[model samples]
Target: MSLQEINFDGLVGPSHNYAGLSLGNIASASHKGDTSYPKAAALQGVAKMRGNLERLGVQGFLLPLPRPNHRLAERLAYDGTEAPALRAAPWSASSMWTANAATVSPAPDTKDGKCHLTPANLVTMLHRAQEWPDTKRMLEVVFGDRDHFAVHDIVPPTFGDEGAANHMRFCEGHGSAGVEVFVYGRPGGKFPARQHEQSSRLVARQHGLDPEKCVFIEQNPVAIDAGAFHNDVVSVANERVLFTHAEAFADQQGAYNAILAAFPDLEVVEVPSDAVSLEEAIRTYLFNAQLVTLPDGTMALIVPEECRESASVWAYCERMMAGNGPIKHVIPVDVRQSMANGGGPACLRLRVVCDPATVDPRFMLDEAKADLLEKTIAEHYPEQIDPDDLWTESLEKHVVAARQALLTALGIGELA
Candidate 1:
């Protein structure tokens, strides 16, 4: 069998109604910053997300971060970063460190697990963050790393500016024609100055997208830096844009409603204030990066299910499918630690263009191997093959099988 492409149209977002996969974070020891109750709880949350992804046959790659380093600390401090006084402000270094730390690590070539100074190796690993073993051969031999795909990149205007440009340069990544909400800069944290906004606009123009397509919104006044929550302006798929209605900070509802008004064509669903904690809400608003559209015109959000007690997973699934028919599904990943540290499922998973013909067989094979590998890896390398790692490997195998299956199924090759 050969590979096949799985349509991404319906694979994004969460649902209150249907079942789907989730991703999880590693234990606390794996995270950066001081070990505190908040950090511990976040790690447990990441565990849940990992369990969910494994159950759904999704794959995740793990990126490890070292203990607090002066280099990174100095960079963060010099960047004019601000910490919100709010307990829920999601931009705290501790939380952001948790997220960023997961994405950095000891070099693969380094046996001591020490950070590597080579920029090339660093980029290679970052690319690997989105690589799957099943698709490795095809990607390496046919497409190479230079030709890949990404749905979107939720980047910090400063640090990620060049990264985002590089993504577009190599992948030709573009924005969808749908509505987008831009949350203007917040109070305390560093906001992108007019120059930054202009730079962003220039990038959009380079991609051939209209700058007017973006709608800017304001953040809560009491909250530090409005730019911290800028990512929340648009939903995952670019189907709908969210923004603040009034300039006054702390008006969550008004801001949300304003976003709704901007896109009358979209079915605006209000996320209940009590559904998730302020911390969870802030994380959701900041970290979500994956955007996938379903076949039914509804959207699926692959985000961190912060309040496990309420099952944020099930609720999102339900909301997307409500009245729109049964074509929707929600995939809640456990990145409790990631989210607590200001990252989400979207942040952890980097999107790349996939050839459908090369993916179908792999998907099926992945399903078959998931349980087997899960048991085997868990039994042998319990500490290493965390639930997320197991799923990632299984999914890689599935992609390989999918490619072979597609070829065989189409009679393009002889069955072994």
Candidate 2:
């Protein structure tokens, strides 16, 4: 089996809007009540996927989950919730950020020889809390082969589990056995720390990971309060490289010590606070990049175009690449729409390390499929979605029709 990492990016749903549901996310909060461009947002996501497909040989995508979650709407209506935000929550297309979809343990990391995936409970936010049932159904359909994969239901929602956004793994190569790192946070901060220590440990055990190879660490509450809601916003790991910000962990040095104790050859490419402040890092989503290793073995940091717009960020990137570093290329992709909603290249994707042949072909991406997705979005998706546009009968029909069109085009049966 040619074990490699395939980034399955979420196809942005038609209900994409800015109701500002996610707390501790500065971008999402600031953009509340703003009219969102759904077509452009989804297209930007598709374009990013296309870029990845062209850059790497393989790319996969998860479809727009069924939206305007009617059951949720009915329950909210019955509750007679007066809060506009709560009323609008049912229409959230936040699943477009697949990093929260699940936590995956590749074959090499587990005791059994099959890959294990646990859908995140995401119990922290009401909007996201509703995703696991549908998310699990979709996951089982795509990764259904029992011989090569084991897709488990979410760990009990008692504690929040935000999936891969809070998980990282370090290994000598893509196919090698790796040390898994689960980052959690303590409660009591101004903003809720989403990943609980108990939850991370539960997920680690649920995946049947070798206890000796697993390391659970704490996230810096300082960073969380400052809008680094998920660990991905401040750090990302690929193969042997750990690219991160200076203030990414509660005890930065201790976190390094923990990982190093497991994986001795860990090459950390740390960015100091002097060069880029945490606020600036969060704004540009510098750490929330797709740090991928190319076919030729050259590593590339796929960043949001906003990173290039930040003079300081791009300058630092140029300087880093100029040196003989592990990450040779800095590729910028346009995902501005997702960025404005508190997600970036990293947030939009879920990394599953496995053989592509083991995955359902319908879920994979190619040039022709990219064109088909583009055509579908252009023809069916609404141009814009205002907050008020959410409740109307006309818009509901349009959103439903658009998603049905996508499912038909992709040959994916309705998400049950």
Candidate 3:
């Protein structure tokens, strides 16, 4: 079976705001208290998805989760019967970054002959910690096919599993036997190492993955200090290619050696420190860009608009595309709203490799469905969502109703 890698990007939610909820994320902190454009944010995400479909000829998309988590706020013992924080309920649109949605082990890599997914606990951040319950519910609905998809409960929060953000898959092909690299951070780093080594091991075991095919690598502490909050921020892999910075992991050579041992033909594209410093790479999110094999068998880099602005980053990309490398094309996209919150193109999606026929029908997308989604966003999503608006009683009602309308429009229905 040939597996097709589909990117399921999260649609930005209606309550999208910048409350500086994420602590380690530099952009999220710097832009805290700034007014956010929820309507434009959601539409921008939709537009990016459409661009991917047109340019890459691939279609797989996810719906925005319902927001203003009053239930979760109440569970956390917040006095929701009154105003302010009660009404705010954190207003997290962080769900827009679906990269942390789950850790997926494709059928080819699993023992049960079924794709397995374990939703992230998101325990490192308070706002994100509340997301799993709803996230699990959403995944269960989207990947409900028991024969092909297994959506498992998140690991214990104490271990701190951050999902696919700390995981990467490398193989001869998606359907072939592959190596699963799980990168974890230690407690000594300036920033908290979000994904625990124990958590990654547990997830691999739960997925019934072969231990021989699993390799655990510790993230570089220097990278963490420099604000590479997640491994994906500095490194990303697809099929046989691993594109990363020179200092992406603690043992860079070890990671490369292990991967090379597993997939001998692995093409390691390392951006030397001389070409682009780690700071610039993280700042411009050069590594966070999505590296995809286009339908024509040529590869394309889906980069953030910031890359176009950075001279060094743009120059490196130009040189790579000009060479006979797997990355043959470069396409920049505008995701400023998501960028302001410390997420880039890769951060905004979860890559699932499988046969489309094995997944749920409603989750699949095409150009026609993309247009319909855009129409739905314009019709129902909010145009702007000021931080102050979250305190109003009416905003909650509108946000809830809007999500229902979106699900109804997409035929995915309401999730728990």
How many clashes in candidate 1? Answer: 77
lDDT of each: 0.30, 0.92, 0.85
1-416: candidate 3 lDDT, tens digit per residue = 55778889998888888887765778777887788888888888888988887776676777767677767767767654544433454678888899999999999899998889999999998778888888898888777879888999999989998899999999876777788999999987677889899999999999999998898999998998888999999998988899999999999999899877766888999999999999999888988888887767777889899999999999999999889878888889999999998999998999888788777778787877877877877887777777777757887777877788788877765662
**Residue lDDT tens for model 2, 1-416:** 99989999999999999999998999999999999999999999999999889889899999877878888878777353459778778899999999999999999988888999999999999999989889999999899899999999788888999999999999988789999999999999989999989988988888888888999989999999999999999999998899999999999999999999999999999999989889999999999999999889999999999999998898899999999989999999989888889999999999999999999999999999999999999999999999889778899999999999988888887563
Worst 10 residues of 1 by lDDT: 10-19
True-structure lDDT of candidate 2: 0.92
| Leading candidate by lDDT | 2
lDDT of 2 at 56: 90
Clashing pairs in 2: none
TM-score of each: 0.42, 0.98, 0.95
By TM-score, highest first, what's the ranking?
2, 3, 1
Candidate 1, residues 174-291: lDDT per residue as tens digits? 1222333333332234432111233344334333333344443444443323323323322233334221112223566665555445455543344443553334344344224344
Please give the RMSD to the true structure for each candidate, in Å: 14.1, 1.1, 2.0
